[model samples]
Target: MQQLESLIRAAENEVSRQMQVCNACRYCETFCAVFPAMTRRLEFGAADAHYLANLCHNCGACLHACQYAPPHEFAVNVPQAMARVRRETYEAFAWPQPLGALYRRNGVTLALATAGGLALFLLLAIAMKGSLFHEPLAGNFYAIFPHSMLVWMFGAAFGWAVLALAIGAVRFWRGQSPGAVGSAAAVEATKNALALTYLDGGHGDGCNEEDDRFTLARRRFHHLTFYGFMLCFASTCVATLYHYALGLQAPYALTSLPVILGTVGGIGLLIGPAGLLWLNLRRDPMHGDAAQRPMDRAFIVLLFATSLTGLALLAWRDTGAMAALLAVHLGTVMALFLTLPYGKFAHAVYRSAALLKWSIERRQPNRLRIGGD
Candidate 1:
């Protein structure tokens, strides 16, 4: 028991120390999205630390920015540190429920199921309205329902989901304690554990030039995919608002935006996954210890499948086939979202937060040092 307690104390101290080191590295400011938001504040505290920790979106810009610099080789892993903080925050505040329990466990399955159900319902409704089968692949599908209904219903739902998630995340951030461990001894333990983790490169070496190849590829693919999704999402939003709210029967060009956006988005989605998969394959996993887990591979494959199906639907325009592909695509998206809070995807939320925390924590002289001597 004494040995165990001592180890824990050592770990806490290490984490705290590394965090301080990261906070001192002002170079990270350029890459960190949250830096601008928190830099304006004169006073920094635990609350600020927690908030900043939650703000990091895990874009990996900081890792690239700090390469080849002093203390660059050191244990200042922004993404991992922020993820730890975000996990602590969520553990501290999320309401306990069966759904939450499921979310924590098999998030992918639950997400897939939810998306599948929604897609089925939507397809069924379209069929019942006799609007599922349409002429001229690019024709407007909203002619059956009042444009007002689509805008008020679909638009409001999407907007509300975004708002709610943002609010929930902020609330969670505000509720967490500064450190995972409460007492001084516990803090020390955490710091030591963090130190050991860094020394071993548990978060993996962020300094490798080879790794950058994959990282850059991922970034390019992601950028394409993101813009594609944004275009499609925005088109839907505009179409709904203009047709429903304003009672305007927009032309086929306006209504066909979803198809156009979907096609573009599909192309990006395919490019990203294909490139990433190639990169993942070409690398020597044994050399770098970069083996992806089955779940991770499954997720990637599902995403690729989703993209393929989306493109197929656009080409075929068969209601039944389109419905199936849409179901799969949405299921994959949901799985991605559900995995976000717990798995690797959590980095998106925590990385930004960590940046904020780093900005808030005052740097101490002689504390900066790279990992592994």
Candidate 2:
């Protein structure tokens, strides 16, 4: 309790201190939403720090643009500083606080859990079919796992993920105490989030990556990954309707809507995650918190594995490899869902809420009169 509060205070203090220096510099104010939001504050309180942390996209443009960056006496690394605070914010506000610890060691835990899940599913497959690889399972995955069992397994996991995320989002929102949001503000935030506007560094150009070179590659990859996930979710929903409502079952034809959507989405997931992992590896160390690499990589690897296994299953649905592939894919998906609330995925949820607040705040006046001309 007291210790937790102290930890939270320490994070807030760091964010506030760095942001004060950034406010004084004002060089990167136009780079992202965080700067403008920071300007609104004459001083950063805990709530202000929390809001600013979430508002930050961690785009790394400011770091490259900062004259006071590392080796300088000021040592102003906004991205890395904000990132550390943001991680602590997630844990401090995480619902069912005990699960917050998972965020600390998510990398190893994600890998082990994913592998364990795969083994569990494989054993189940063996028990059901008396073999690892069954003959020509086609797309009738329920044949191997049974429809009821599949529904129960995924239903519980997905439900838990949703509930946990919702609770966390609500808690964060309440902490910020963002007052009533108008329809216009809501629309604006939706547009910003959907377009990832901040990732562009508040200009028509792109963000700074390694060596101060601005590139749109990160934004493009993020879009691919986001829309890919959406399409996959849509495919699942359509398939579910086909199963229960339309009397259709697994083994839908390649040209079928669900299969086509999943195929396209799976391809996007593959390319997106692969590109992101490459960028992460080559990214400048000072830009963001180096400690977060493990958590970031965990998410990237899980997403890549899920998509890769899913595509493999689709490709080999008519062969003996389908059963093994299906189990592996299902395991990865399960692991992804299970870790959603406890991993980097929570950042999206928290950030989206912050964006919404920003939208509303924008509608109001700028009280700070910052960016002196």
Clashes of each: 34, 0
Candidate 2 residue 233 Cα shift, in angstroms, is 0.5
Model 2 lDDT, residue 137, Cα = 61
lDDT of 2 by residue, 1-373 (tens): 6776887788789889988898787887777788888777779999888888888887788887778887899888887777888888778877789888888889956665775667576768566758777677656787777888889988999999889889988888898888898999899999999998998876757777777788889989998898998899999999999999999988899999999999999999999989989898888887788878899989988888888889998888888767777777888888898888888898889889999999888777787675531
TM-score against native, each model:
0.53, 0.95
- Residue clash pairs of candidate 2: none
Top candidate, metric TM-score: 2
Candidate 2 off by > 4 Å: 1-3, 124-129, 370-373
Candidate with top lDDT is 2
Taking all chains together, the TM-score of candidate 1 against the true structure is: 0.53
